[model samples]
Target: GSKVVITSVPRVMVEGFLKEYLSVGHVIGTELHTFGCYFTGFLTSSGLVVRHRALDDYFGDRKPDIGIGTSSLYDHLFISSCKVSLNLGPMF
Candidate 1:
């Protein structure tokens, strides 16, 4: 079983959907703005995360074993950095 790291999605949202089979052990995403128990629906000062940069920050000098993402231009750079990548197309 390979480790799955999710980047570029809201941490709260990913946390809810990630399950045991997904093997998602790490995440890099925008931090939420919150007041007490209430969410502001806004990101923290860091703002929205750039997927490729977040991926770089997560792995540092080492590249990830695999990258899986949608078949969109947005994911091109992120997917290219990995040792192997899968573009799951629109259904993804």
Candidate 2:
């Protein structure tokens, strides 16, 4: 089996930034889907710890599906003027 690992700055920073953004409803246009798994976590100024495991008995032998897509207008002047930097590191 292949494994995927996603690492970022200290958990605290990620949680803080995400929490603040979520509170302000800044996360728009993304669909939230529900999965039959129990996810528990605790958050503090520095970070969060979460644990989630899918139940094997509930859905057996089926591969989990995941996908991501983004939409942007290339013709927009603002889009043409925008700049983004991609950092190949734990923090970006």
Candidate 3:
């Protein structure tokens, strides 16, 4: 079985929605710290910016068979590190 992991900087709360909507198995998004159920608007200690960290979280020491993303440099970095990569053009 292949696990679909979505990696991006979408709002913390929207991660789950996107995961479900996209029917992906997991999500790696920028997590925001909250206070008393209210967003503090600050990123948590482990923000998913650097691609390797997100990859470590999901893939550990192993790389995925394929990596897909937009044309941004960040995405390029992530996809390049994979065994195979596909660029879907710019997201914005």
lDDT of each: 0.77, 0.27, 0.73
Per-residue CA lDDT of model 3 for 1-92, tens digit only, reads: 55656455644666677667766666667778889988887878876456656786678778888888889887887888788999998864
Any residue pairs clashing in model 3, and if so which? none
Please provide the root mean square deviation of candidate 2 (C-alpha atoms, Å).
Answer: 15.9
Ranked by TM-score, the better of candidates 1 and 3 is 1
Clash totals for all candidate models: 0, 3, 0
- List TM-scores for all candidates, in order: 0.81, 0.20, 0.71
lDDT of 1 by residue, 1-92 (tens): 44656566678878656645565666567778999998888889998888888877777878888888888887888899899999999767
RMSD to truth, every model:
2.2, 15.9, 2.5
User: Model 3: what TM-score?
Assistant: 0.71
Worst 10 residues of 3 by lDDT: 2-11
**Over 4 Å off in model 2, which ranges?**
1-6, 23-92
lDDT, model 2, position 66: 24
Question: Once superposed on the true structure, which residue ranges of model 3 sit more than 4 Å away at CA?
Answer: 90-92
